[model samples]
Target: MVRAAGKHTSARLVLICVGLLGIALIADFLWASSSSSRFALIGANWAPPVSLLTPITIPNKGVDSQKNNTTTGRVLSATFADLPAPELKWEKMAAAPVPRLDGAAMQIKNLLYVFAGYGTIDYVHSHVDIYNFSDNTWGGRFDMPKEMAHSHLGMVTDGRYIYIVNGQYGPQCRGPTSHTFTLDTETKKWQNMPPLPVPRYAPATQLWRGRLHVMGGSKENRHTPAVDHWSLAVKDGKALEKEWRTEVPIPKGGPHRASIVYNDRLYVMGGQEGDFMAKPGSPIFKCSRRNEVVYGDVYMLDDEMKWKVLPPMPKPDSHIEFAWALVDNSVIIVGGTTEKHPITKKMVLVGEMFQFNFDTLNWSVIGKLPFRVKTTLVGFWKGWLYFTSGQRDKGPEDPAPKKVIGELWRTKLNLGS
Candidate 1:
């Protein structure tokens, strides 16, 4: 009878232990879920800026390992206040008809127009897809006048007309073209515009004060960087004789620059100075080296028509082919790739974002991206920012197969919590 009583006690103890273990697992799951949600809330609110610091690991190199060293000599910091963070809503819309990378987008009224870009295969596409925001659906597809494939082509719009500027075409970094064309949104037709003075690609163009300003691209298939600046004005609404006038050139020009006009002044930032290919028979060429240069310099063209170099970015070798937009009078630079991975030595996509305050000339970490993206089309409409299709992953050199994304993502910009 004593043994039977002891067995009953042991069985009861076993049951209690099992119940305790189950409770512990449930508590752990709840904690993990809450922590993940908190992080998501933080990302949706504000991305804190993070500085990429290279610690001097070589022993006795006379460099302090504790100090964060970057090529720009600026330390990145985040100042988070106790104030409530902004609440953001993200929606996944209809995907594009075709997957593309290095595309441009322009929104006219309720319709969003996506232009030509490199497709999934070897060739570029001239397909034009339209998205109607009012109906929340993608409409019919249109074709460009010509079949041209150029990544990093400049595109801008002045409500009624969309301008397509110089870009590279054909296979393997072919020479840049001076082709410029404008599409009438009302008529659904394209009209040839005055050609650029110099052939280039990856130039940033903006419509400022009824004039189209084109500046800072690469010439000769990105072999040479050009600082040539030009502005085209339509005289008396006459499109036939539109004349492009020369403007003050940028102090330094490079490929894949992000340009925007804020407060009547032009701001250019983040581009590299080197070509993709090294000179023939060079030592670097013999080694098949790639991504030789990257830049993080920021410059502004003031109302006085003078270019002033601003403080360098905290992250050196940043903003190479990234997406940027002016939000709340601040420049928000999104995801782009760095030249080389710090650990793997492969090219890496920078998933973090930074914001530059025009008033104070300071930068802050805004937030992190859900995924890595580059050469994307960014559009701002109705208090929301849209990040469209782009290339994902680290490009061709990535150990895994790269993907050209077609997903359309939008996030509310100014929605208060």
Candidate 2:
């Protein structure tokens, strides 16, 4: 009788275990079939089936299809289209004449004007390198104005004209400058514009509705963040007003933020609140690294000229002011520095490419770069996404900056038809 009772108990335990396993499998099937399963579960640590990661287009009815209505009139949502990964084939292009960081570049006609920037620990470039998209070659470089800032410049282009605003006049944490200049790409000449009332370090600069808007940057001390906003009416590479007029200040102002004007809407995203501080009584403004708060906060200047908050980036990113390119209705941003690692407490260089969909107001990691980098100058030309000239990282797993690179790279953008 005792042996029979033990056998009965063993049989019941086996049945219960099988039942629990069956329930778990059913639950997993249900979860994977759901729409939210397009993205892999957090900490999954395992590869899901390819079909589970395929892109699925869904109709969006709740959002209106109106112009300037925050949706960008996007009728369909391609939320997980880049899931698993997009077809990113980055090809090497002509190398830049010099390596630089904190530089600026703009695409005008068939030429990409790469501006001066920090060359090395002891050097700063004061020249412009032009890349001809037509022939895939670097044209003859030209000298910038003697007064042009070498780094931290806020630049924007209006057709044949390129506008450059205030920045650090020189290297080693030097004082910010108040000078502003505009260049005529056709004539290859630089013209002086009305200087900024208060000099800033890498303020968000953009052109909107016949006015040049400049906002947010580091103060003269090179540590404190500034919230001052100013604008000036300009035309044909010349400022119509002698003085900049005050505008609504950015709610969260800082330097190295990406600024763009899409369909009359102005946006500022990704920057840091603090920067290197100069040591007291230093002649060359020698500085030391300071604690900073890098944020992904995004803001938009609405049609009413009031700032409105928008969906922020997935994580904190900085030094991305010039590392973004507009593709269709999406802004494809390349590499930059992100928050420090939790365990190592070391700054983590961003290797992933981020895409911000204007229509959905959502951010996504579309792909990864060949190597991690920061302050990369990004441009979109003839269906190709081009990025060049920034500080490259040590390796894939290491985020420490290794060296500055001038190798230009481009990949065919196959996001949409």
RMSD to the hidden true structure, all candidates: 15.9, 11.5
Error of 2 at 279 (Å): 2.3
* Number of the top TM-score candidate: 2
Q: Rate the local accuracy (lDDT) of all candidates.
A: 0.65, 0.81
C-alpha lDDT of residue 103 in model 1:
73
Model 1 per-residue lDDT tens digits across residues 10-84? 999999999999999999999979967855543443233442222224324444422553423221121111112
Query: In candidate 2, which residue ranges exceed 4 Å CA deviation?
Result: 1-87
TM-score, candidate 2, is 0.79
lDDT of 2 by residue, 227-281 (tens): 9999999999999999999999899878998998887799998998998877788
Query: After superposition, which runs of candidate 1 have C-alpha atoms over 4 Å from their true positions?
Result: 1-90, 147-149, 235-243, 277-290, 314-322, 394-401, 414-417
